[model samples]
Target: MGERKLLSPEIVQVTVDKVNIIQAKLKAVQDRQKSYGDVRRKDLKFEELSRVHDVFHISMLRKYISDPSHVLETPEIELRDDLSYEEQPVQILGREEKRLRNKIIALVKVLRRNQIVEEATWEREDQMRSQYPYLFQN
Candidate 1:
């Protein structure tokens, strides 16, 4: 077979740029996670807060009792806009990171085809069953 061609400098630079962009995004996502408490959300540098809608401060014991003697619930509008971007599951962040990393690897592979992971031997469906008779049942 002929020798594999190397990745162009332009392709590598573009891939690097994409990787940097994703890294910045990941940092922003992480920062948002810490915004759950009041201070960070309030401290946001947004120019306008109109988008933060339907904010509420829920009381824990509101549902348990319903008597005049009980203190009245004081539900309040907490945030002016939705800051949902600040919150994402750690699993999701991990997945996103993996996705970006995979993209870089794919781009790199365009210039050079190399295996990143070796397949498990057990996945060979065409292999003779007699080779591992213990794996089969009567």
Candidate 2:
């Protein structure tokens, strides 16, 4: 029979180092996912606020444009000429809304990509855990 083999100290140390490196990489990926989620949330909130602002501005402009005499009586319509500038606000809001929407779409795409990567990693981890429960068990 062949002699029994034993792991040398250097080999054991290398194995431990590899495991630690894998664990650190996994943690970094998880942290990155969390950061992306937080950024997405903030973008959503900003989009919502921008939508509200746009709607309010549109409503006010509509009121002034549709009934100039009545709105002027309220003293809020101080300058009739400013109505010409209303279109600019609408255009600006439209551009901002579009930008925010695009950002949201981009963020969602990134999140989906991250999820796919994480899912694959999780599956591999699960398989490893099942195959080597003793090694993974705390």
Candidate 3:
């Protein structure tokens, strides 16, 4: 094991002086960085106009109170092992016949579960009937 030297008063003073020097340099660096930020910052003043209502007191502004109705409740969707969930048709919105090159194809606007009216997709009526037999029971 190496021999440890006993700390003298002079050696302790020297170490404290070195630490103070380092702290002074660090403080100077921090002040210089703060001065750079101060240089970029400016006071904003709005001019008073006859008809313009630009600035108002903090008391004049009303705090936004969010309504419970504004929050949309999303229905829970079950996922399979592949992270893909099957979409179930809620109801048939409308039916349309598309004239193809040779035959007339029947299309249905299927309102899927958890989907909005605008998000409803047009699927083949025959395909929807085969898949969801409960839909055509009525």
Candidate 4:
């Protein structure tokens, strides 16, 4: 069989250019993935808050049902009575949950924006890959 000839210089140049463009696109995708990771982490914080809120709500409901009058008049006093004197920790945690919930909402908005950016990036990447299937075909 005849020996295979090397790629022409023009073909080599074109391949290099294509590779550079793909590399740039890949970097952009990676940056977007990182942004998504950040947003996902923030989402977890909200999920955690949701869990705490659910528990607190249940406990508050139980207290109200058990002692409606106390709960109605001087809820603050009843709340304090319901918790131990070392309740400072619980109060701090509640505050943290609220803060996390607010932050998580903000992050969700950012995530939605990133989703649009990511979709555009993926569309471009898919277009390039389709145009030069050999470049990305595994």
Per-residue lDDT of model 3, residues 9-126, tens digit only: 9999999999999999999999999999999999999987779667978999898898878988777889899999988898999999999999999999999888899999999999
- Among all candidates shown, the one with the greatest lDDT: 3
- What would the per-residue lDDT of candidate 4 be over residues 1-138, giving only the tens digit for each residue? 999999999999999999999999999999999999888774333333444433455455543356555644432332346674321110000111114534532111111121333332212333444544553434
TM-scores of the models, in the given order? 0.25, 0.28, 0.47, 0.28
Candidate number that wins on lDDT, 1 or 4: 4
Question: Which digits, one per residue and each the tens of the lDDT, describe model 2 over residues 1-138?
Answer: 999989999999999999999999999999999999888774434333444333455455543356555643332333366553221110000111114534521111111121333332212334434544553334
Candidate-wise lDDT, in order? 0.43, 0.45, 0.93, 0.45
Q: Summing lDDT over every window of 10 consecutive residues in candidate 1, give the lowest-scoring window.
A: 88-97
Specify the highest-TM-score model's number.
3
What value of lDDT does candidate 3 attain over all alpha carbons? 0.93
Each candidate: RMSD: 33.8, 32.3, 14.8, 31.0
What is the alpha-carbon lDDT for the whole of candidate 1? Answer: 0.43
The all-Cα superposition gives candidate 4 an RMSD in Å to the true structure of 31.0
Q: After superposition, how far is residue 38 of candidate 1 from its true place, in Å?
A: 6.8
Candidate 3 is scored at a TM of 0.47
Ranking by TM-score: 3, 2, 4, 1
After superposition, candidate 3 runs with Cα above 4 Å error: 1-74
Going through the candidates in the order shown, the clash numbers are 5, 0, 0, 0
Q: Which regions of candidate 2 deviate over 4 angstroms?
A: 1-3, 42-138
